[model samples]
Target: MTTVTLSGVGAAMPQPGDAPSSLEWLIYQSATAALVDAGLTRAELDGVVIAASDQVDGRAISSMLTSGPAGAYLNEEINVASSPAHALVTAYLQILSGTHERLLVSSWGKASETAGGSIQAAERLSVEPFYERDGGLSALAATALQASAHRAAAPDRARAEAAAAAVAARNHADGMTPADVLASPLVAWPLRALECPRETDAAFSIVVERSGRAGSEGISLDGAGWCTDSGRVAERDLVGLPHLARAAADAYERAGVRDAAAEVGDWQLHDYSPDAELLAYAPLGLCAPEEALELALAGAQPVNRGGGSLRGEAPFGGPLRKVVDAVSQLRAGAGVERAVAQIAGGFAGQFQTVLVIGRQA
Candidate 1:
């Protein structure tokens, strides 16, 4: 098997409605910066893989307009409509096939460009028209439903609240107290305004190469696994996150990781909501679902060092940001030999992807 390394990463964070640059410009800046970080030029790239959402981009076939900016000029290009982490997975497999030696993966979300109510309309359209869509089942409602279910199963609301506060504090300079989080406006039955992530206009790019091909030492892409649950929301095991468990299991086996809690040092979780992060504990083999909050409040788990989605979520690009953060940590000698980056996509966390990264030995 060919070892794949994440050679470099770059990103552009523009406050919504504050930057005059177009979305393409953000992509170009990040892609070019990644190439520079990797000590490579566009002429040396084999291909480009992009992850984007047509609805969020406010254009049909958005990739056609965006690929060139991603350094895909005259080169092979592929697009993933799913999470940006999936683009990394695609690039990794392509390298293993020996058909491509180097690939650039890119994704972005310009939520600021979306018209009012359009983003929610896009989320509603994800469900079947006949049943779920007619019931006003948007992403927020579904996540609230899942959180409600998780609360019912665990029945430890205070601990869960504390854990969420801990995460918020870790990510934000002025962390919210559990009371503050609860006092925030209740968007859904159980989800509060503070508990949900704020949307941001952000873009990320990563340079991946077959190990030794770039002649640049980098973080090793040790393992990757992704799984999608049934599209029907009612069919999913909301509290269990079974798909996440399966994906993590697959990734762990590939990386030869038998004990994740003991072996992996950092966790970059794509937390759509505070409960969503708690739900992932058991699935990722980090801890039991019930114990997750306890461990989090106790400062035992090294999850979300980069503030996760709580800080700013860029729709499809959030997962790619997690990958970038993981690689940065490893390269900076974060005292961990290995780390895990997990991303969720689709409505109510239906799709899950896990990547295990390690420092070059």
Candidate 2:
């Protein structure tokens, strides 16, 4: 297996209401922060990977849209439409293949401009379009249907779910109550407004290099598994996703983790929604499906301790933030002996990515 090391990581999120700047400004801000974090000058960057939806941005290509401003003029670049996590995986493989040694991976989305529906729009394009768009199925509705079924098999612990939300919200500096979650208006059946993640604007970036002290610098990417399910919801098993289970199994084997629950003391979760995180727990083996709420609430397997995307709304930034938070937990050196940083894409019977990071051997 090819091991990839993280040399430096940096992220920039536009404040909740930063006056909109031209595309160039957005790209420059992100690139500067990232290069600085990596301890390299802009001229030192050798490669760059960009992740963003130009269609959603109402632009043609990121290169054309943010050219001189993005500092792409400073290095080589490639573009993809998936999550930043997706970009990282591709970059990791490229490095392992001896294609590139130093790389900057970034994804930026301005929810302020495109609004919050981009995730669903991007998701539908990846799957059988007829099943979702022609059927008029929104992601929330799909997740709600799944949540309803999950609750039927088990039961929704309103308090536990709320507590998990509270944990994420408070840690992120937002202090919403369990009652807030319970009373929040419904977006889709069984999925209260609070149960789903809010749409916030932000950008994310990370730097990976082939040469570095693995465990000493920061959390290294030990194992990564990403897969996509049938895009058509009707074609997928609504009850559960075997692909996720398979992905987790692959990651576990790669990381040499025999018992994830016992070995992983902390988790940085992408709980974009109660059901998504709830659905995620079992596949990752953090706990049994129904047991996730209890485990999360009791702090047994504390997830989204950085408040997740729920605490703050930064679409492209969520997973990157989760990775950074996990790295912090691993580097704290006080407690939290071990940790795993996890992120997902294509939820609701679609694409998913799972990454396990920790102190490398």
Give candidate 1 regions above 4 Å deviation.
16-18
lDDT of 1 by residue, 1-361 (tens): 7788988889988764564778999999899989998999999999999997887897899999999999988999999887788898999899888999899999998877774756877888878987677898887788888888877777677677677766665654355566677678888877888877887778899998999863556688989999999888888899898899999999999888999999999899867887788889899999876688788788757888757787777766756888888888787785899999998988788989999998888
Candidate 2 Cα errors over 4 Å, as ranges:
66-71, 116-132, 155-173, 213-216, 316-318, 347-349
Worst 10 residues of 1 by lDDT: 167-176
For candidate 2, list the clashing residue pairs, or say none.
200-313
Over 199-255, each residue of candidate 2 has an lDDT whose tens digit, in order, gives 655666677767553322555777777777775566777557777787778777877
Could you say which candidate leads in TM-score?
1
